[model samples]
Target: MVAFHASALDGVARNPALPTPLLLRLLAFDGGGDGPPRYAPQRAGLPESAVAVILAHPNPGARVDFAMSKLAEPAQRARLVDDPSPKVRAALAYGPEWGDPRASVALPDDVCARLLDDPDPSVRTALLDSPHLAPSFVASLATHHDPAARQVAARAWEKLAPDERLALLTDPDPEVRRVAALGQCRRDAHLTAELLRDPQFAAEALRRGLLHRADAERHVAERTHLAALAENPSLPADLVERLAVDPDEGVRLAVSLRPELDETRRMAIDFTVGDLDRGDGVHWVREGLADPEVLRRAATSAHPLLRRSAARSPHLPPDLLHLLARVEDPVVENRLGIHHPDTPEEVLMRVYARLGGTFSAWMAETHPRFPREGLAARYADHPDGNYRRLAVRDPAATPTLIERLSHDPTVWTRQAAVGDPRLPLHRLREALHVPELASSAGANPALPEDEMAAVLNRAGVPA
Candidate 1:
């Protein structure tokens, strides 16, 4: 309302899981701002009333932003099918659940028919490569006029029948053949030997099951292919030993972290440990986590990233959690505190005490085991507002300290205080008028039912 601030809209967007109608009024007031629409507020699974607010609006930019986000239904998003803006139409081509890796949303059949032949070539291209598409849709693209579209069909080789796969693999387009080759190599092992000798495809070919002892011996020294060979789960054990001593420090480093190697054998190898922060979870780890043995192996891995990944499992047992606690990395300790229920109070304190728990304040309030006794007294007088904010976690916190923090200089700490039940009702009401504090204050469970409804009424919702 005050010069179209993004926070007014994004505060609702950032917590899409909340059953709230705030996004409706914010978008209604702003008309979705200038230029292209942002995606944050339009996430899939938002309440129908919130989604209707945007869908019922006439703003092309708002509709475009909505197209790029997850949707409540395929038909809901498909309403934008004949939109005038080419960009809006193109955004719809990305289909449902845009960035979600675990689930794909299938567009309604009627919508898919329209988008398949959209006037904009760019839209058609996006539809061709869109996630959540069925295999049959990809198979039908095998003979599309656009070679790029045909290339997308080729990548879906497993989904295609043998004859259909052969047609795309033999397509006249060189690039299409290349994109299809890696997948096809897995289907036909005999073809791998030929591809292995070709420099253009050798690295990919080396990772296949077709790579025998002779193949490993031959390509083991090819520096370009070492990383691929190192990644191959089926790589020969003797070859693993040979690569463990390879001249390339990168190869030796990779071999040292192989999950199959015992800690003693792995530590004995001379290798440079990679210092970059590797991110959480590998696909293989997720696939194999069902087996208790796999989880135990990954939890105790010499690779720090693998251990960090195992720490994310809610099912991780106590002994493994303790084993990870001994790991020297502070981030690993934070992962434990964030996920595992059995993570002890001292470990949580250790992580927050070291890292200030910058992005993970939820633990202080909701973690069942977080030490509540004396929490307020320990941190209420701390000079660092970040640490002082911990006082709000205790229900028995003195009213004087809660009042002081409700107006703390740091916004994060201030927001936390505004949501605490110990905060005076008058201060919580005051926060509802402050633009930056309104969303958190509105969501506070401590706020009375009628007062919460009144706050929503002010935001233009029916109380």
Candidate 2:
């Protein structure tokens, strides 16, 4: 055994791919089962003779190690069933051998039965990880004193009879019940009714169309279930219609966001003119006000809030959009800029003129319909550096204008100038000499490869 450990260590040091049989032989001789065994020999990789030698070892620790080896035959494993050491039996009961199908002793009924009665909680818990564990054994674990063991048993829910599944639904352990409620057991009305009382199961119950209208209503009334109830396909249309006008804004908003919207249901939710014109309230009504007449009323309302909300509707007539565009309120103008993408060039020009140089005006100027001619030049000398930067980035920027900005004292403008695709390669090379522009100029794709290398070399940066 000492020779085998030394030879195994030598083989590992030299080849590193030393076979499992050699390693298991070394483990059998190591005398180190002070804690649970850590390694399981692969059955396919180790010869049966090696498994026999380890199984017959005088050291209980060696027997414990061999008991868990996947290579141990069922009859050989059975011999350890009554072994004097609990640790050896425990190792046999919960080891990798039970989980692997190719292992000769994998999930044998007798072995599982023996482990089930074993005092070790770990052995019982480990038994649950077996895919081949019988339903009867799983049923026996349902009443396990350990909550964790009961939870593990709950995972075999599909294999449990309906009566057995129903019994677990009322299990003292909430986790066990949670698992049971989500299992494949028949979700009859009784089970549904019982689960509906718990918020955790209520959402899933609603999703599966298990709850009746009265039960669903009770669940939805709770703030916790409002969002889930909205998403529940089983929610009755009448209830959905009722929920649309629910006093809770959150509940109403949840209803509004549902994927399917029928016309009657749409009208029932008051997102239109008569509803309170709260700023966020507009979002709830946005989808409902699809009619052109409703949108026009909203667009023309005395309240700028309603008008701003109305401006967001895609159905608004062009005339209403033109009118909203000319409204002096910055909020209304900004909303128009965002929602009125198809605004006529004349209206955009008029809005830009009225708004002066505000962000909304800049948005108008950047619109594709707005004339590009002289636009960049107009903002090029604007006092705001942001406008100047935008002007430098404009497609209308001329080579001379780009070069002028390249020498601007502002580092950002200079950076923008160096980044311009139209900057001549020769000008880019010259700009590299300016320390501030050097990094940006060097990184520019237009800079010649040789010149980029020289610049990087001068900066002491490795290629």
Candidate 3:
């Protein structure tokens, strides 16, 4: 499909090994059929690489396209770029890395400016990675309102000055903040410390209303900023003391886990540990009780959570747990059961799964009132693969339940039966061998095409 002018070639003959039809068609406007032959490339004789490069090079001048692909020297690349073909310019603007220093640096300033706003994403990506681009110019582009442009700009923003860095930090867009926070700002001790020290930094960050989707995300940002300061073990003692008593559980949790916790800070931790709102206070107290005296003091507290936390601690006396086991508050009892699922099998099975503890033994045991049928159904039908797998292994599980699950519409449910205890070996073999069921079983969650084929292979079913 290579275009050859009848007049340009010594004798006209189609080259069977010519470039693709599209490339030929792209050249047709210049020479083939009734078109003028002035633009034909035979004047220079097309290079071997030119033909291969032009095959995928969008319709335009071959030289510029090759230059854009970085197939030529920087001088050659710069020369061909002036070709009066927007297609060529577009390709050069967005083309693959040429690695030619001049290709990035020698680009006309106007063209470089235009490339910043290029509609094609590839062109913008190429421009962003261009080492020749000035930092100031790149910074201007990085603050672009367009997300794709901004994202490209972020990659370039890594080399910006501290003042410019602050500009991006305070960018109006959350995407900008998120990328900045996670990528660049995360490594800046000065920036992160400044954010932690500034009383209005969190408020300003929150007010800018970037990525405040959840309380946890806010907590994470706050924690990240605080951690930036906490990493400095020589952090001011007053700052450490204030943070130790911070109302946020995450902050207190940070304090509790901080290696810097000393006697004065330990007293602060004790006070903070006593504050229930500071995230599972009992947890901190129990974990804090690596000191035997602390455990003893915590064990005698009137608060049940503290006492239960004390009982659950490996360092605490086992006799303390026996004493609390008789107190009768269901909440505390549930915690004890949850914490000691292996130690107190009888009481653990008595509590509900929703109350939060290992439920394998509970599922195996038949409760007189609620019965196991619904829970069994959830186990077989649950979206989570692990839960379903666990459910199928229970002794209370029956063949009927396994069969229902084996043919269930959902692949996860059906696959659950492969390792199920209730399904007989023959049933498993049959399920694996049946082409339709087996194909469905092994099919990719996205494409179901040879879905049946894939499932059969996985289930040992014949294609």
Q: Which candidate is the best by lDDT?
A: 1
Over 151-241, each residue of candidate 2 has an lDDT whose tens digit, in order, gives 7667777666767776787888888887776663234556667666676777666544455777777766655567556655557888887
Candidate 1's C-alpha lDDT? 0.67
Model 3 weakest 10-residue run by lDDT: 7-16
- Roughly what TM-score does model 2 have, to 2 decimal places? 0.38
Candidate with more favorable, higher lDDT: 1 or 2: 1
Kindly provide the TM-score of model 1 when superposed on the true structure, using C-alpha atoms.
0.68
Compare candidates 1 and 3 on lDDT and give the better one.
Answer: 1
**Model 3 lDDT at residue 356:** 32
What are the per-residue Cα lDDT tens digits for candidate 1 across 236-275? 8888888888888877766766666787897788875444
Number of residue pairs clashing in candidate 1, backbone atoms closer than 3 angstroms, sequence gap of 3 or more or interchain: 0
Who wins the TM-score comparison? 1
Deviation in Å, model 1, residue 194 alpha carbon: 3.9
Q: After superposing candidate 3 on the true structure, give the runs of residues whose Cα lies further than 4 Å from its correct spot.
A: 1-64, 67-87, 96-110, 119-140, 143-145, 183-463
For each candidate in turn, the TM-score is 0.68, 0.38, 0.28
